[model samples]
Target chain A: MKQLVIHPERCTGCMQCELACSFVQTGTFQPSVSVIKVHVFDEQASMAPYTCFQCEEAWCMTACPVNAITIDNVIGAKVVLSEVCVGCKLCTIACPFGTIFYNPESNKAFKCNLCGGDPACAHACPTAAIEYEDSETKDWVGPWAERLNESFLTALAGEPS
Target chain B: MIAGWVGKVLKVDLSARTHEVQELNLRWARDFIGGRGLGARYLYELLQDPTIDPLSPDNVLIFATGPLTGTNASCGARYMVVTKGALTNCITTSNSGGHFGPELKFAGYDLLIVAGRAASPVYLWLCDGEVELRDASGVWGKGVWDTDDMLREEVGVPDARIASIGQAGENLVRFAAVMNDKHRAAGRSGVGAVMGSKNLKAVVVKGSGSIPVADQASFLRSQWKKKASLRDSKGRQNFTQLGTSSTLMPINAIGALPTHNFLQTVFDGAEKISGERINDDYVVAHKACFACTIACGRVSKISDEAGGRFLLHTSPRNWKMAGEGPEYESMFGFGPEVGVDDPEAIIAAHWLCNDYGMDPISAGATIGAAFELSQEGVLNGTEGVLEWGDAGKMLQLLEDTAFRRGLGDEIAEGSKRMGEKFGRPGVAMVSKGQEFAAYDGRAMQGRGLSYATSNRGACHLKAEVLRADYKDPGHEGKAGQVARTENQISALDSSGLCLFLNSGATYDDYIAEFNSATGMDLSMDDFVTAGERIWNLERLFNLRAGITPADDTLPKRMLEDPIPTGPRKGMVSKLGEMLPEYYDLRGWPEGIPSQEKLAELGLEAIA
Candidate 1:
């Protein structure tokens, strides 16, 4: 499974992620439509983007009395169905991360659905701060290589190749 | 059904605390395009009082958004404030990019026209379709940052964008700007002073709305294509990495950088305060305005020499010493132009300008003039106020100017006035009362011509033909280029697009996007003609304001003094050679637009 990994420090707070997400989800270019929220902390000169974590036992899914929220088997995303949604405030209150947002325009609750495994935000980010990485991939620079082979190549290059 | 417009405007009377929604003038909209052009048209038409004072409540302030503003258009994050500037006493159209413009557009209005004086300090709170003037007494006399912080809590939405003035505006500092998103500013003219005069502290807005475009699908595709192009652009990349300070080293190398009150062409301390050094030493992070792909905004933290001098600086993030800027202009203004090399102090001064709500370029240039006067001993009235290389004194003067204290009072009137007050009119490095930005006009012919002809006095962004001006060895064909570029820039500025984005997008791309967003079948001639019409209208406004053809001139220093050092040595502004050609190209009767030219550009009524 690939997951969106966000390094907030690397983010320029351009909100390209929000715009990309909004266009994919709502067929519009509104920041409020985007599931991903970039909270600006101007005084500190920092910005942190927040989105649904897809908790193992999703609070929004469990708290939905109308059964509008459900987990997708393919992507493990806790998705919201606007048709089934009653615009109830319960799921929003139950969510711990405050990632689940209710849209006034649609009168439904919505959160990040990972764009069905190909999130537009990760693709749109100019800095690659938001990356759709294979979860199993190890944290290393350049292409992954075995330690002995990498050491041999590094030795051959006479520098950290 | 113009696709991009919200189709309405809010006309607010501060005196009555009342607002009325009216249908946007379609004829005017069709003619002016939007933003600066549209705003200028509104100001020119609506301002009926013959003897309206700039700081008086009669002088209207128009906050307008372009058709592409708040749309998915690349760099479509700008809004402009148009008014008669208190500093320059000319038609001032100040442009700024941030969340505010987009938010204003999202709040369902194309323009906000503010007029009349309030009985007390108040702020306009706008949400969706609702608008009201709320009491701002608590936020009164506060810095821009503090006001924004308090207002957000009051509004109970952290995401709401606020544009506010600081102590400088409250004190009616002539060069005060309306600071938005904390640091992003319409930071050139004295628009803030007009706001102050009206007793309006800020405008708070939050919009949970979507833009209804002509065709969403095609618009999205167009935006995507543009974004892809921007991603690959080399200029965009350099801007993101180096910020506007990217030009600092190059200009310094060419001897075009304004140094020591425009006396020297090159600076001894230029390298110390150069972009490379600042980027390496201080820039801790990068940020951006709303929807900006090129995140040229810098976040720098400076630890004063003896540890933290500014503790918990009351910034939004509550950082001890973090702020946006010391961008190229402010850096030059406070650094080499004032003969100071302290980058940290420049950053500190930049932070002060943001907080206090003043244009750093004008303020710093004004201070540079003061320093020059102090050195000459001709400043009998104001002595011992400033000295060369005195970063500490410059900071003090900045604060004083914001607060309207002592010699800071003199500095607040700007360089032109400050120079005269001290008995040296020749020392003032200004064009038509406003201080010029970085770049020696002598070394850059186009800049000299642009400065002289700029409607809003001595602004570089009016038509920054820096490359053509800098590299061109002679003054041939410069006038036509400057005039054409100025008209183009005027058109571009009227659109809710950043001129910086022109690096990646071509003129055709701009035309396509404008046509796409507006659903208007505007040909290239129509677009360019509209720009010419808008430029002429602005000129008419300035002309009506009593600025004559004689006012079209470079500063004495640029016209008389030769470049003393660096690449373009002994070169002076050959404005005399270019002025005639420029007038001819503009179809102007001796610098004043001819009636035939005005009618050709569809300004027959005004003509």
Candidate 2:
């Protein structure tokens, strides 16, 4: 399933994503409405982008009293259904990541739905900090270490392989 | 109905001790947009008499917010403080990015128009729709940070935001700045002095309401995408990493970083005072305004080189504070401008300016001018007080100037006035009575022309040609480039977006955001045209104030003195060569706009 992934180191803390999200979801520019948040640690000279982790055993999906939340099969994104949402805010409390939020204007719970399999946040990102990738197909780590190990082995074999 | 707009105008008359509230004129809001543009329109309407003293009760200070401010938009926490400039004696509008703007929006007011004079020192407090004028006698004499803290305590709300002045403004320093959020400031054009003139101490705001937008869903979605884009942008990277000081090396490399009071183009110790050095030496923490995703602000400190044998070490003033910046200009102004390449000295001077409440640009320029005069034996009786590269003496001068003490009294009046007093008016390096920012116009002709012709005088942020020229410095297409950039920048400033956003977004992107927010069918042409109209209006204001075509020229030094070294060696700004072309492109005859063009811009009657 396609999942939204972030390379936090690449984040510049511009908050263009927050603006984009708030504009799309609420039709106004308000950071409170943004699902994705960028927290900056100035002392360290770094910025980290946080969003819905989209866990396998999602606490929000199971905690919804009226079953208002559902997981999308194509993108593995947990989405909120306004029609089913009773504004109970149970999912917001249940979610450990605090990504799921209740919109005061709509009185309904809202979370990242991965923008229908083509997330606008990723699309608009100038630095390609965020990407939508097939979690199962793509190797998330170890490539660099593997390449280094292979090079060391080739050196031991006395060949430029 | 934009979510953030309060749709109201708050008017206060200090002389009468009266206040009134009025509905914001939707027509004006839609046409002029907001912030600087709206404030300009209001100022034009209110101040018909061109001779009104900038510090008099007759003068007006208007704080205005655009349609985008307080919205969910990125970097939308901007507001304009508009008044007659104490520095230039012309139209001065300074914008600051902080929670104060957003809080003002939440208070359900689009604009705060303060007019007339107060009987005594007072402050205006606004809580949502509740407004009152209270005595500020106790905090009147305090510095910006102290006043802010006192006001916050008095209001008993830690979240309450305050914009106040310091000793410089109280002493009527021509280049005083209006500080807010402890460090952020409406930091140019002497807005603070104007406030001090009115006997107003501070404007405190506490807002707890939300801004309503036309479409919540769409705005949220767009905001998210914009956030992501900005988070990854190269501009954002540079800003986040090095703050605005990132421009130091590039500008220095291009010989645009003004050195030695702009008498030289190259600084041999540029790297020592560069952004990388700042990051490595004294960046204590990164700071950001409320809702700002791009945390470009730095709260830095330097304590390594204290108690040293320096001119300023008459008393050990150990420096440790988290001020907003030593942005590229400040670094240049406090660093090479005075021939002091020490980063510690630069940071100390920066700290003193913030603590004492002075505009770094004006202060630095004045000191630079003084250093030059001293070097030439022009200031013979000053007792070696004005030495180049003497950081301690610089700090001492800054203190004296802020308080208008002895020699400080002369320097406090700004370089233009001081230079005239010293019988070297031509060497003062000012236009419209305001001092130059950090860019040496000799290196970049376009920037030189921009500085010469800028309504507020010698200000780079007013209109920058360096960004355009960075790609092609020698391009003759610079006139059009300046015009286009000036127009768009005017629009953006009016729209309440941070100018830094221009690094990642174009006019089209801004227009898109504007259309989505206001639901106005504004085209790219309309947007640019509005900027043109705004520019013309400012020009008309200056002309009405008796500033003529002759005033639209570079400093004699910038025009005649060729840079001694660097890539721009032997180069002088050809402002005279470019002015006519620039004037023609601006739809003006010679250096002044024609009556026909004025009429087309709805400025004929005013002119």
Candidate whose DockQ is highest: 1
Tens digits of lDDT, candidate 1, B382-458 = 43746678877788788889888888999998988887877788877888888888988888888888889899999
List each model's interface RMSD.
1.8, 5.5
Q: Highest TM-score: which candidate? A: 1
lDDT of 1 by residue, A1-161 (tens): 66677777778887878878887876666787788988777666778777886766688988999999988888877899889999997899999889899877788888899899999888778778788877754332223236547877778899544
Task: Give the runs in model 1 whose Cα sits over 4 Å from its true position.
Answer: A104-107, A137-161, B306-321, B381-385
Task: List lDDT for all candidates, in order.
Answer: 0.85, 0.78
Error of 1 at B278 (Å): 0.6
Which lDDT tens digits does candidate 2 get at residues B328-361? 7789879888888888778777766765678888
TM-score between model 1 and native: 0.94
Q: In CAPRI terms, where does candidate 2 land?
A: incorrect
DockQ, candidate 2, vs. native dimer: 0.12
Please give the fraction of native interface contacts (Cα pairs under 8 Å between A and B) kept by each candidate. 0.67, 0.17
